[model samples]
Structure formats: C-alpha cells, structure tokens
Target: MESIWVGERVRVRGIEPEESELLMEFDQDSTFMRNNDRLHPPRSKAGYRHYLESGVGTPNDDEFGAGIESLADRRLVGWFGTNGIDKNSGVFSYGIAIGTDFQRRGYASETIVLLLRYMFGERRFQKCDVEVYAYNTASLNLHQKLGFVEEGRRRRSQYFAGEYHDVVLMGMTIEEYAAAYSLGTVESS
Candidate 1:
C-alpha cells in the first residue's frame, strides 16, 4: 500500500530502494545500536537489500518498514515498523530508531501515535508489542507514557556493551490505545 500517515511533527512512509544508503547509516550508528538489540551481525549493502525485502522473516512472513520523516523540513530522520506480525493472532511487534541528530525531538512519539492509529483502527490489530533494553530509559518512558504496560521482563537476557542487560517487554492492547487516543480525533493530531 502506498500510504503516508502524517502526524503533527512527523510522517511515516514506505521505504524506498534509493534510501538504502540512509538506512545503512542508521545501522552503523553506535548510539542507535546501543539502544536496540540486533539479531544478526551488521549488514552490508547487499545484506540490507535482503533485509529491506524480507524483514529477516520475523514471527511471520508479513513485515513492513517505513521511513520516519520530519514534517517541518521533510527530511528522513529515522525508520520504524513491524518485523514480527501474526495476523491470525491479531498481535504484532514493532520497533523504532531515530538518528542521533533527531533524538529529543517529538518525532518518535508522533510516529508511534500514527502507527498505532493505523494498526488498531485500519488493520484491526488487537495489540502491539515492543521490547526495550533496560539501559534505554528514554524508550521505556516513551512506551509507558504512550499507555503501554510492562507485560514482563527477561532479566539479563541481552548481552551488549560488554555486559548483560535486562530486556523490558511492553504491550498495549487496542482497548488501551482507544482509551489513550480517541480514534475519532487521531487524524487531527
């Protein structure tokens, strides 16, 4: 689907082949890598191409990736989308990574709000899941502030930066999203 979901500060659009280099830059960013857990080693150009095409075959065959754009200047600041999706179960897992320069802005929150509206209102998803490293307090706060609850945690489940870190699992059901953000007013945001 060629759809662009726009929010007040950011917009989400489908990934383009020409933007592979930009995606590579994010992958190589040290700060971005620290907050996220990578399942595979760093990818080369060809590898990223395959990833862009296949989404590493997470949970199910269906996957979606979109570039996060700044609405003020129309620049690509990051990417976010679901790599793990199970339509039959009405559940999906998603993640987001903002470029170092783009952090602290409201782009991540705006993108997430738009994503939830699309997933819950249009796609009919029952819930959305996310995993964040304990060290990443900003991410944890963001999810919680957006109405996601702490479903569980895997203590010291991830090894990064020469030490083990707890993995915080967070989820928000459609009911929660509706309560936090009314579907009728989401478009105006």
Candidate 2:
C-alpha cells in the first residue's frame, strides 16, 4: 500500500513501534520543543508505543503523519504532518520536527519538497500554509528559500520562553511549487 514517500536524501514512511525510543528524543530536546511551540514532558516508551499504534503516521480522513528516514543510514530523522486541511478551499497547514542531530543537513528542505509534491501534485491542493515562531529564524529562512512568501505576522501572539513572540505566517501556492521545482530540479539524494 504505497507506504513510503521518497525524496533524494530522505524518505518518509509510517512511524514504527521499534522507533519509539528514537521518537522520544524529539520530546527530550528543549530547543526543538520550543521552536515547535511545545511544552509537554517527554513521553515514555509505552506512550510512544500507544501513539504509534494509534495510527498517527497512517493516512486519515483530513490529516496525515509520517516519519522522515535518512537514506544514508536508514534512521528515522524526524517527522512531519498535515493538519487543518480544507477540501473546499484546497488549502492545508503542516508542521515538521527534525531531530537536533539531523538539523541543517538539507533534510528539511527535501522533505518539504516531497510533501509539496504529494499535496499539490497528487492531491491537487492549491496552497500550503505554515506558521513559524519569530525566533525560529532558520525555519523562516528555509521557508523563504523554498519559495514560500511571508504572508503576514501575528505580533506578540505566542507566549513562550519567558516572553511573547510574533507568529510568522508563510504560504506557497501550487504555481510557486511548479516554478521552484520545475522539471524536478530538486535533485534526489
């Protein structure tokens, strides 16, 4: 059943039970959690097991999740998913969390490109939207590098790390994706 979404350096597939321990590392990373605007304590192995068993990475009605596996070592590097899918509007929002060790390796870029292919090419979605905390300059830069335009910002809306910060809103349309990656310019691997 089409389980894997292949990219050049990484492939995304369903999260596995055995990888529960690895998944916990994301929660353990205080910086990663803060960037993603999360504050929950780390989940136990059993909790992770329960989460995987709950079919998180499996395709659902409106949203879906998947684990990013690096091709170099076939290790689960991170995860991403779509939420707030609007069928009528043909718009969707997504989030991603890459392990600290896996950051700044172009993995996030390729993963997002792969997801754009699925959402815009396969599902025929019109636009993809994302919100990044203002302090996450890396993410904001990555989004712009990938051709996502800064639509606006919610000033001082998100409170964390002892102060409030703006929520940077970004979006990419299907036309923009086609232009950026025309003829599959983004090399695989």
Candidate 3:
C-alpha cells in the first residue's frame, strides 16, 4: 500500500511487489474466504503473485489501477480497484477486513466513501458495482448506506463450503453517485 494515501488511521495503496506475503496471510484466513466467495481460489503462490502484481503494478490491458491496504494496526485490511467492467465501464469491488480488533468502527464505510470519490471524481467512471454474498447482512447494509441499489441477484450462484449461496449485484450510477456523495464539497477549497 506504499503508493496509496494514508489517512489518520487508514493506509490505501496499490498492492505492490513487496506485499506478496500479505496474500499468504490472507489465504490462511477462512473467515475472509467464506465471506468473499466471489473471489477465485489461488491455485498456487505463483497464481496469487500474478494476481497481486496485476492488480496495481505496471499497466494491464484494462485495469486502471488497484490498491490494498490497512485500516487499523497497519495490517493488510482490504483491497479495492477500478477494474474494467465491460469495455470502458469502470467496475469496482472491495474486500475489507475490519480486523479481529477493529470491527464495526466505520472503517469500511470510510474506505468505500474514499473509493467512490476516487472512482467517480478522479477516474471519471460512469458506474461502480459490487457483488456480495446475500447472507452477509452487514455488507448488504453497508452497500445500501453508500447509496448502492440492489441491481440484481443470481439464484444459487455460488456454492461455497458446503452450501449453495446467491450472489447479489449492487450498483450506483455516476449520476446517482455524484448526487448521493459529497465529493464536490471537499474540492471547494
């Protein structure tokens, strides 16, 4: 997260070459994997490495840039990015760990707010979307609080662990995004 910004308690940065170990730590956490079922499993360290390097390093064909960072205690907390949705559409997805110590302290909201601002204001993207496990109420509420509408749902989409799970697609358009968020207020200095 060295390339990204550091707020009072959060550090956001592009996942870099040095953060390979972080991926290993993440793989060890079943709690993280269970919630984020949309992510594909890493077959090997090499695959994870390729993903990490592709996320925010160099210039990929469609990926503008992405970041992974810590929220509190300076640990690997989450990852977010402006990935290509269709052709020029900018789709975004984030996976955040509130941490064993720092759960439910508005960190995820803050991070999403920051991400939305950057994606809509700076990147000039027309839309932003996220996929969440339908059973995750906290995550579902968070997306709602951030003004994302329930775009759609895929029935029995994901079969994680031992059960079938549905994936919910949520989205906020650039129009709704700008009106719903107060990014313009911050720039009026």
Candidate 4:
C-alpha cells in the first residue's frame, strides 16, 4: 500500500529539535493546555529540546509522533501522536494538538484524515479509539463529524479547571471508517 501523509492543507513529518521552542509555546497556552493536556504542566524550552532530542516526536514500530506542517508555507502548526493498543489485534489510538492560531482552519480535520488514511488504509488497523474531555465541545463535534461513534463516557474522571469532567470515549472500526470515508477503494465488506 502506498503511504500518503500529506493532505490538501497539511502534511506530517518528523519533528525537528529546533521546533521544540514552538511546542513549548503551545504548551504554555493555558487555553490549549486546558483542553488538550491540562494535567501535565508545560515544560521549559530546554526541557522540550531534551524531550525532542530523545526521539519523542518520531514514528517507531510501536507508536508514532510527528509534526503537522502547513503545505502552503511549511510552518509547523501542531503535533500528533498515535500508538497501538494491541498491534497484533489491529487496535490503535491517536491524539492531536493544533496551535491556537491554527485552530478553526481545518488543519486538525485534515491532519486526522491523513492519519486515519495511513492507519486504516495503509497500516490496515481495524479500529481507532480516542477519549475527549466533556468540556471540549469542538473536539467532540469534530470526532462525531469524522464518524467516530460515542461508545461510552467515563463520568467525573478527569479533574481540571477546578471541576471534574466526563471523558467521552469514541471509536471507529475499519468498516465504519471505510463507509464514512469511502475513497472508492476501501473495502466496505
């Protein structure tokens, strides 16, 4: 199968050490952190450099971590990470974080499509799952729009912003992905 990571507006590529400062800047944004990863405190720029140098943002056999860049200007806009829950069983999960400036511009959606195409179409993963915090309406809506069903919810499981919030568990099987994003070649059966 042909590997295609570039979408109409964005492309996936290895994260560079110099981009650590950009990522650290995103981590410092409270609004972005609150929705994406509120629990972990933002790391220092030097810490981020060390983290990236350790290969935390590169694809490996068990998982993948990459930078999302704009196809137009090639500027880094976000980050994406994915890993197998059970590689042998074809189960996996992925998450993304687009910079505040990049939000609402379709980069997140296209990045997801590119990731899904790679995971489901090329890698042949059977299922993909994700957990969205209840307060993140945009994410919930986006996942729903992308055809990920709300499989269940974990109530009051995550505490952030001085309140406990529900964790919405969503998933999509290969069949559902094929049906929703039928590229005319995906197997529907």
All models: lDDT? Answer: 0.80, 0.86, 0.65, 0.84
Better of 3 and 4 by lDDT: 4
Which consecutive 10 residues in model 1 have the weakest lDDT in total?
A: 55-64
Q: Which residue segments of model 2 deviate by more than 4 Å? A: 1-4, 182-189
lDDT of 3: 0.65
lDDT of 3 by residue, 1-189 (tens): 232245555666666656666666666667666775434555576766776666444544335444534554566666554443464556555455443334466666777777677666766667777888899888899889889899899989888678898889998888887787655433232
- Deviation (Å) of 189 in candidate 1: 21
The TM-score that candidate 1 achieves is: 0.83
Q: Name the lDDT value of residue 114 in candidate 3.
A: 70
TM-scores, each model vs. reference: 0.83, 0.91, 0.72, 0.90
Global CA lDDT of candidate 1, please?
A: 0.80
- Candidate 4 has which clashing residue pairs, if any? none
Record all residue pairs in model 2 with backbone atoms less than 3 Å apart, i.e. clashing.
Answer: 8-188, 8-189
Q: Could you tell me how far off, in angstroms, the CA of residue 82 lies in candidate 3 after the best superposition?
A: 3.3
Query: Can you write out model 2's per-residue Cα lDDT over 92-182, one digit (the tens) per residue?
Result: 9999999998999989999999888878877878999999998899999999999999999999998776898899999999999998774
Candidate 1 residue-wise lDDT, 1-189, digit = tens: 223387778877766666677878877777687786564567788777777677432322236667898989888899876856888999988889898888989899888888888788877889998999988999999999999999999999988668888999999999999988856443432
For model 3, the superposed segments whose C-alpha errors exceed 4 Å read 1-8, 38-72, 87-102, 184-189
